[model samples]
Target: MFVHPAALCESDQIGPRTRVWAFAHVLPGAVVGADCNICDHAFVESRVRLGDRVTVKNNVALFNGLTVGDDVFLGPNAVFTNDYNPRASVKKTEDDLLPTVIRDGATIGANATIVCGVTIGENAFIGAGTVVIRDVPPGAMVVGNPARHIGWMCACGRRLDADLACACGTHHGADPTTGGIVADDA
Candidate 1:
């Protein structure tokens, strides 16, 4: 069921099982893939591409020249900026929009800010309140103002214990049952 009331959905490429909730705007040129959940008050501008099974939370803004790949979990208020520098007198084009790619199965924590021209590697985890200023390596866990590689994270989104298992290691729970992170964001 596609529901777009008072929001613009000029793009014909939005796939099925995807719901564009009220007050969320998807522009004409955006291409959204299957099984995506677009929450309220989120703005997806032109030239943005959301891959399969992407879950976008509320109040998030995905600007142009940004590619969010499959199984990406964009937490509430996480933002992607496409420009390194800006002047009011200068106008930017599609070429001026620096490339930003959130790789497959990555979990962008709430309120994280990814700056322009950086590639967040696959299955990486960005902590809440982080301001990412550089390229995050695959399966790395980063946190802080300018995010740094603090440790590794399981695919289940749990901060790994002393076993040093980060980026998809199996952990034994209290029931003696083994659990693993099949993908980013649990």
Candidate 2:
């Protein structure tokens, strides 16, 4: 729990060994887990839940209804939207906000915009500056303004070979039924 004096962590639910850096603000009711890094100038809303060892980079904001799983990496300035049809005239309640879930080991690249109501699957890799509008399958690697699956990634963060084997000697494959990839050992 190394919270910099410049950081404002109003949450009592922060786990041990987490570091909140300068200018970061963790609002009350936000649950941050152990060994997580809340980087400089990051903002976490009340309803956001971050799991263990998650890395939230500088200038990123985890708004309400967003849940980040363990070991997730959020790149610099990554944006998340909670409202799909936001209007200045409308005052929306918490129930009106859409939810976004980033599963364990997923990596969202710098400046990516994750739209609400999507589940980024386990170990999914989102490239820099991507605008993700849909659910990303497990182990899928996507890029571009409207992110599209360009390749598959291994759980160890390497691009998978054609046979779905990694250099690290891990074997993974896509599930035909769920359309999600899974580690064979799992």
Candidate 3:
């Protein structure tokens, strides 16, 4: 892992080829995966788990109980909360903090606030400035303050058509179990 001179990465578990940029602070006990790019001014607290090829942009704060899957894109200024009912006077343990999961290939847009205990499914796209209060289905595109599902997103990051077809030659169908979109060949 390449940690910039101005960055403070106290974790010894960062994977190979990961770069922690300037002004970023990755505390001890954080597990960062290979080829991850943690940009400037980002704060990764202990107990966070990041998968390979993740991109954490500038000004993002990833608190405890966050598990980010491979190829996830966390846009600039994205905020992740661990506690749903936070109080300055109350000191909560790890068990008291709710866990948030960002599945593989998901993209969290800039300034988005992801509330605790939500599972963002694979390849989900969260629009900029959106507030996510619940679980997001796979291949779904969400926006606005409560994170309404506006449309479907292809794994290549394009908006899918009404028939769930993409110009990239991918076809998606609904998964009955999760009520989420899934690639036909997946």
**Largest TM-score belongs to which candidate?**
3
The number of the candidate with the highest lDDT is 3
Candidate 2: tens digits of C-alpha lDDT, residues 65-92: 9999999999999999999999999999
Candidate lDDT scores, in order, read 0.82, 0.95, 0.98
Single out the weakest 10-residue window by summed lDDT for candidate 1.
172-181
Error at 96, model 1, angstroms: 1.4
Better of 1 and 3 by lDDT: 3
Q: TM-score for every candidate vs. truth?
A: 0.86, 0.98, 0.99
Model 3 Cα lDDT, one tens digit per residue, 1-186: 799999999999999999999999999999999999999999999999999999999999999999999999999999999999999999999999999999999999999999999999999999999999999999999999989999999999999999999999999999998879999999
lDDT of 1 by residue, 1-62 (tens): 47568556767889988988878888888999999999888899889999999999999999
Segments of candidate 1 deviating more than 4 angstroms: 166-186
Alpha carbon RMSD to native, model 2: 0.8
Candidate 1 differs from the real structure by a C-alpha RMSD in angstroms, to one decimal, of 6.1
**Candidate 3 residue 89 C-alpha distance from true site, Å:** 0.8
Model 2 CA deviation exceeding 4 Å by range: none
For model 3 the local lDDT of residue 184 reads 97
User: lDDT rank, highest first?
Assistant: 3, 2, 1
